[model samples]
Target: MVYDKVIEIIKEEFDVDEVNENTLLREDLGTDSIGLLELVMAIEEEFDIEIEDANLDDIKTVKDVVDSIEKIKG
Candidate 1:
């Protein structure tokens, strides 16, 4: 599943042990602004797709990211 790979990437990028669909960036992971940008870069490289910078503001949880990847893949 895409989420499986996404979770792995997120775990590695955020230095977290685990991440689920509901995991929130700020509340659950304590991700800062720079970290958020890094996460976007990692996602782009992993999936080989470019995401609009404005859309980054809409991303809040792990599920949002997975959805974005799926949408882009589709």
Candidate 2:
């Protein structure tokens, strides 16, 4: 599942012990612009997909990332 895969990637990338749907990409995980770029690249490589930059602007939480991935995959 993209959600599970995305969460695992996020946890490892952010060095977080745990995360949930409500976890904020910026406030909760402390993701900066550069970190966000790295994360997007990582997810793209892991899933063999492309996450457009415009779409990224709408991503705020863990669930948002998963949903975006699902949309790209679909």
lDDT of 2 at 59: 88
Q: What are the models' TM-scores?
A: 0.93, 0.95
- Predicted candidate 2 versus true structure: per-residue lDDT over 10-74, tens digit per residue: 98999998899889999999999889989999999999999999888898999998888888888
Mind giving the per-residue lDDT tens digits that candidate 1 earns over 1-74?
Answer: 88999899989987899789999987899998888889989989989998888898889999999999999999
Model 1 scores worst on lDDT over the 10 consecutive residues at 49-58
Runs of candidate 1 with Cα error greater than 4 angstroms are none
lDDT of 2 at 16: 98
**To one decimal, what is the Cα RMSD in angstroms of model 2 from the true structure?**
0.7
- TM-score of candidate 1 on Cα atoms, chains taken together: 0.93
